[model samples]
Target chain A: MSLADLHFFKMTREPSLDALCAVVAERHAQGLATILYAGGTDWMVEQEMRAPLHDEPPLVVDIGRMGELRGISLAGDSLRIGAGTTYLELERSAVVQARAPMLVRMAKDVGAVQIQARGTLGGNLATASPAADGVAALAAYDATIVVKSARGERRIAMADLQTGYKKSTRAADEIIVAVELAPPPEGSPWYWRKVGARRAQAISKVALAGVAVVENGTATRFGVGMVSVAPVTARMATTRALVLGKALAEITAEEIDHAVDQDVTPIDDVRSTGEYRSHVARALTRDLLRQLGARV
Target chain B: MKISLTLNGAPRELDSAPLVRLLDALRGPLGLTGTKEGCGEGECGSCTVLLDGDPVNACLVPIGQCEGRAITTVEGLGEMAHLSPLQRCFIDEGGAQCGICTPGMLISAEALLRRVPDPDEPTIREALAGNLCRCTGYQRIVESVRRAAELLREGAAR
Candidate 1:
């Protein structure tokens, strides 16, 4: 099959995880890669248009009908978000707004309202783009990705699952079922910021989500995600330590500056320069830290 | 796949690929050409339609997914002979210039009014965020929605 023979499959309703996994496994066994279709924003137009299938067109499996992979629920101390839930749903979801406001902020910045109305969180994770807004927020919250295949189900840390730039550990036969995030630590100040060329619909040059838990004038557990600056979105260990062990006021400017340099290893890309990204990361870290301090 | 939908108060059936966009199915198969395809992508809501009362980009929605759903296209809202309140307001308020974006603008406005009958400026702006009007700069379009709301309110009062 060639691009001319490319076919589209549409489901009446969202497909069950088992059904989706079966389809993937069947296609893989046939030596055919299945292009998981959701939202149809990035997939239907951009990628397919840019690179037409030369041999057998990948089987397009539509998962939009999978009702099981939709909705947000709070389970114990964690919040589980179905992979198929759109950004618009996340933004409007009361549970997400209350428990994970930063994720809501990330959803709002995913794309224009039209894109948000269709783009799903699972799509973002599956694409594994370094500049993905949801990835940054998920990293800050220590999110866990739930993968389901015909064999069974397994959970992987968001950081570990996202191995490299535009790459993930998700098996072809596994469909991302949901993402579970531990609730924000008590009394912790949360802040998220995205630096893009324009406000709406623009991809980020650098994005960051920071969570600071301050107790007795000292930081406890601090987490941050430096998006679009590395091979994959990651947390900064040195910066986390700097903010965690010491009071914001006592943390010297040099220490903060050094942490920023140590934490981020950016690359020169079309969106921004590595030096500029490093500079902004440092400035944003200090500003966010100060903002968190004021909140407490 | 054969998909059936109640479009604009009328029932219609289409034979198309399951992945065929609702915009294409409507325009090509069913011949409801009111909905324009500006971007083909969802970025431009030129193909906005009411999918089960919520306004969505028709281009992004596959035809198969809309099975047994109530779809309101621009043609269903009003016609040359009988205009809906929104269609009337758009004309009276000069909401359309080139008129290419008018159909989508009307459907989006209708969807908003169905949810919030009496909406303020911010609400109006946010509701119509998906629909883009390049000619009028949206000031007149916003005015048209307000006018339609007044008409709706007056009709209810009477």
Candidate 2:
């Protein structure tokens, strides 16, 4: 069949990972390549419409109906959010707001309300865009991703998931079912900031999300995500150390800037210049530190 | 795939791809032409529809997922014989200019009224944020929602 012969598919209710895998296997056995469709926001539609498809018609496996992949729950000290849950759902979730306000804030900044209502968390991670808002937030919390396939499930640290720009370690048969994050210890101040060309609906040039535990004028654990800097989102080790032992007020602007610059490897793109991204990353890091200091 | 659903209080079915967007299915298969396709993507809410009473961008929703769900399109809101209160308010208050964004605007307003019988300006703005109106600068759209809310309230009192 030609590309034009291909069409859209829908699965109203959530389906199991096994069901999805079985469907994919069936399509593959039929000698047709299958593309997984979830939310269909950015990747699938654009590629299908723009790219040349001279090969066999690609079958779409709609996994949006998988109910098992929706919801946010507290499992002991960790928080588990189902991959199917939309950004809007996370923004409105009281439990997420109370425990991880930074995540809630990130969800609100993703896209317009319409996009937020439909874009799934799994889609965000699977897209693996360097500028993805949720990925930066997940990185800050040192979150763990749960990937499930027909064989079983495996948990990988968030840092290990994104191997490169728009790349992930997920196997062809595995689907990310959920993300688990350890709750921040009490009294820790968490801060997230995203700087884009426009306030809403625009993708980020450089986004930063940081979680710091400051106790009695000393930083305990500091985690940050420098988005759109490298091929994948990453934590800056040097910056983490600078903020870890010193008080937020004690960190100098020069020290913060140096650490941030050391952490990121941004490239010049249509959205921003590499130098500009580096400059903003430094400025944002300083601003977040100052904000945390003021709050304390 | 053969999918069936109750659209705007009417039972309907169509033979289409399960992955086909509900937006395309509504316009192509079912021939409900009132719904406009603005972005073709979900960003623009011109293709908004009520799925199980909640407003969603039809472009992003797969037709197969809509099985057994009650969907309310712009045509379902009212008829030529009798317009829904929200539609009447939009007509009287000049909510529509070019009319491309009307269906989506009405569906969004309907959702807001269903949730909050009387929504404030901010609430109305938040509800309609997903919708983009190039002709009318949104002042009139917000006013129309306010008017619709009052009409619903008055109807409730009666």
Give the number of the best model, judged by DockQ.
2
**A196-233: candidate 2 lDDT, tens digit per residue:** 87556668999889887777767776778878998898
Query: lDDT tens digits, residues A1-296, model 1?
Result: 12222244434333467777887887788887777777777765563355554564566667775777888999889899999888988988998888888888888776666677778989888888888888888888888999898888999897688777788898877888899988775545788888988666678988889765667777666778878878888688788877777677777767888988887888898899999998888888878877766221
How does each model score on lDDT? Answer: 0.80, 0.81
State residue B99's C-alpha deviation in candidate 1, in Å: 2.4
Off by over 4 Å in 1: A1-15, A51-54, A185-188, A252-254, A267-270, A273-276, A294-296, B118-120, B150-158
Q: What stretches of model 2 exceed 4 Å from their correct place?
A: A1-5, A8-15, A22-33, A185-188, A294-296
What are the RMSD figures for all models against the true structure?
3.1, 3.1
Clashing pairs in 1: A13-A65, A14-A65, A14-A66, A15-A66
TM-scores, all models, native as reference: 0.88, 0.89
lDDT of 2: 0.81
Cα error, candidate 1, residue A277 (Å): 3.5
Instruction: Give the top-scoring candidate (TM-score).
Output: 2
